[model samples]
Target: MPLVTTTEMFKKAYDGGYAVGAFNVNNMEIVQGITEAAGELNAPVILQVSKGARAYANHTYLVKMVEAAVIENPNIPIALHLDHGDSFEVCKSCIDGGFTSVMIDASSKPFEENIALTKKVVEYAHDHGVVVEAELGTLAGVEDEVVVEAGQESYTHPEEVEEFVSRTGCDSLAIAIGTSHGAYKFTPAQCTRNEDGVLVPPPLRFDVLEECIKRLPGFPIVLHGSSSVPQEFVKLVNTYGGAMPDAIGIPEEQLREAAKLAVCKINIDSDIRLAITASIRKHFAEHPDHFDPRQYLKPARQAVKDMVAHKIVNVLGCDGKA
Candidate 1:
């Protein structure tokens, strides 16, 4: 199938009580890993490109890679998306550059400014047959160029969603309900130690999500910064000369619950990065004599496939949902 918008995918997810996985892609291995897993599972998937990704890999290259994935996996639905387009110009570029979906992240601006910016992008995107996803609240953490300090994070106010959606005319909305970007989603002070002294982050604010659902019935909701940050990968990184400490992420159980609700799309990036990094680090440690990129990246790509497969079956519950 050709690249499609998130419209039908979200509708099916909202009705079936499962969320489609939106995985960030920066290079060929990551794209292959994600789409291959989705294709094998018969699941719908979204390949997201952030502004940083566009800077890293040229937009033309990224789009061509996604097109290649589409040709290779013809059985499942796939959408090429811009993850966090910070401005109307950025959104417009993606819309004109063959992106099936784009996100106009104006949550950092004031309410009126956000609506105006999103509305402009929506008008342009809709005319071009691309769908728009707008964000309402700010999430704290670092993902590429997006950065928010710990105390600066704010949860989505359910009271504002109706007005925002009505005026902006965005196809879907991403709400910040305690989920954050990057591996260190929560600080050590914000979490409690478990029986084994592992840090357990605070829970997501479901009450706020439920209220938003009440106001926008049947609308597709999105959760960004939704990576689970598997500890085994963290352990492997640390074991192989990496020094990341106190890195934690949203629990898969909580994300599973969110998927069964109004949440129709879950963005996962850090987990894939962690899986690839850990695998590469381990490979290099074991075979220090090997210098070929393919030698190490082969296992790294497989690690991504394995991690994505787990999320499809366990966290997203969209396996066989194509």
Candidate 2:
């Protein structure tokens, strides 16, 4: 009923071959949307908060909102998580502030430094009945509070995973295997449709993933910037007079395949944002006189709920696994 750690969720996902969706929450609407979807699907969910989000919504408000979701969804497991924590202080703060899990993402630092930082957080978190996730290879996405230039995008080195895990003792490891952050993951030049005119993003580097699995064995792996940008959401946004500039994400099939492997947590955020924006845009276009916040926000919340439900059914593969 209360917030739990990701340890059990990752273990079950590893054994069940379904990755739990870690959807970032910025406000009450997003939290309500993500938890309601997961609850309806009978799936365990992770409500993650990023540093930018904490600053935007305030940390106390986000924590209280997730607590409220727990009270509302007593049948399903809900984990409050800190996403992409960059410092010891950040991770420690979250661990102390009632987050069930916290990610100490020091992958951009030197290898030794990353291990040291992760170990520190893990040691502290374990003492407090919390779980810790650490990133090995830096992802090339522009998620809130985590911005890396495209030039910096690089796949996780398989050779280092074993050592990183052995030393850090993190409960889960987030890896980068060609899935970058943000909606504009690829350009039109990088993709072309088949005979059926279905979209096909560039293939994920499964070879690298294979190598990581070979090194870590059954260790839980995570995928960040994992939002599968729904074409329907994009259509809604564009039709309502918003330009997204050909945003794309990793295909759902690839994510499904990864779920069957070591992946237990798939981070998603951009899709939720896109869904809210689309609904709000349409409401404004249709109701020019609408001024009350709830007039448009209510529809936006419903749209997010629908989007998350679709994701639980179509992506992440967490349905019926609560």
Candidate 3:
């Protein structure tokens, strides 16, 4: 099937109490892994391209790769999206370049400026038959080009959501409740220790989310930086000559609960990166003579596939809902 906008998908997710996974794609293997798993499970998927991804793998290449996935898996729906678009030009380029959806993340700007910029993008995107997502709050952590310090992050004010949506006319809204941008989402000080000596991050502000839902009433909501940062992958990476400490993420149960509410799209990028890095690290440790990229990338791709499948069946709960 051809690419589809998130309009119908979000409507279904809102009614069905599940969210679609928006996995960021950087390369051929990553695209193949995510789409393959989604295809097998008969789930609709969103392949998102970040500005860094467009810079690393040219925009044409990412679009073509997603188109190829569309051809290879005709049974399930696929949407190409631009993640965290910071400017009108960025969102317009994606909309004109065949992306089914785009996000305008002007949350860091003044409230009025954000609404104006998002409304501009929304006008352009809607004219081109595409849907737009806008963000209202700043999320903490570093993810690609987006970085905000811990104290600097602010949760989405539930009071402002209705006004933002009414003025911007964005198809969906991405809000910050507690989830942040990267793998190291919380510092050691912000988290407490669990029985296994693992750091448990602070719980999400579901009260805030519930208030937003009550106000928006049937409108689609989105969660950015939703990766669970699987502990297994962290241990694997550390064991194989990598050093990353206190890399925590939002708990999966919290995300699951959010999905059952108004959240229709959950952005997960760090988990894919972690899965790939962990596999490549382990492969290099086991095979010292491996030089060809494919030698390691093949396994790395499978790691991505496995991780995405787990998310589909377990975390997002969108399997068989295509």
Candidate 4:
């Protein structure tokens, strides 16, 4: 099938009690790895690109790579999305450029301003047959160009959701409920150490999520910064000439629970980076004489495929859901 909007996907997920994985794509390997797994598993997937990604790989290159995936995997549904678009121009650019969906992240702005900005993008996107996703509350942590301090992070006010969605006409709502961006979601100070010496981050404010669900009944909810940084990958990276300390992410069980709720889209990007980094690190360590990019990237791509497949079957529960 051709690239599709998240409308039908979200409707199905909301009723089926599952969320579709929206994996961020940067280069050819990452795009191939994600879509290859989705194709094998017969799952519908979203290939999202950030502004940073567009700058790094060039917009045409990224879109063509996604187009190649679509052609190769004709059986599974794929949606091209713009992740965390901060302005109306970027959302409009993606809509015109070929994305099936775009997110207008005006959450950092004042409430009225956010609604106004989101509504502006929604108008353009809907007219062009593209779907819009908008964020309500601010999320803490850094991802690409988005950086918010912990003190500044605010959970989505359930009371405002109805008004925001009604006025903005957003197709999906991304709410902040303790999940943050990047590899280090929580600092050690905010978490307690478990018996295994791992830092246990504070639990998600499910109460807030539940309240939002109650207010926006049947509307698709979204979760950003939802990657569960697997400890195994972290250790692998650190063991082989890397020095990332105390990196943590949301737990898998928690994300699984969220998927079974009203959440229809879960954004995961850091995990793919970690997986690729770990595999390349291991490959370099084992083959000091091999300098070709493909020598290492081949294994790195395989690692990504494995990780995505695991998520499809276990966390997102969208396997065979195409």
TM-score for each model:
0.99, 0.96, 0.99, 0.99
**Tens-digit lDDT string for candidate 1 (1-322):** 8999999999999999999999999999999999999999999999999999999999999999999999999999999999999999999999999999999999999999999999999999999999999999999999998999999989999999999999999999999999999999999999999999999999999999999999999999999999989999999999999998999999999999999999999999999999999999999999999999999999999999999999999999999999
Q: Candidate 3: which pairs clash?
A: none
Off by over 4 Å in 3: none
Q: Clash number for every model?
A: 0, 1, 0, 0
- Which ten residues in a row are the worst by lDDT in model 3? 242-251
Candidate 2: worst-modelled 10 consecutive residues by lDDT: 193-202
- Where does model 4 exceed 4 Å of error? none
lDDT of each: 0.97, 0.89, 0.95, 0.95
lDDT tens digits by residue: candidate 2, 1-322: 7789988888899899888999999998899888888888999999999999999999999999999999999999999999989999999999999998999999889999999999999999999999999998887768876888876877899988888888888988889898988998777777887898755788998998889888887789999988888888898899989998678888989998998888888888888898999899889999999999989988898888898887777777889999
Alpha carbon deviation, residue 315, candidate 4 (Å): 0.8
Error of 1 at 90 (Å): 0.7
TM-score preference between candidates 2 and 4, better one: 4
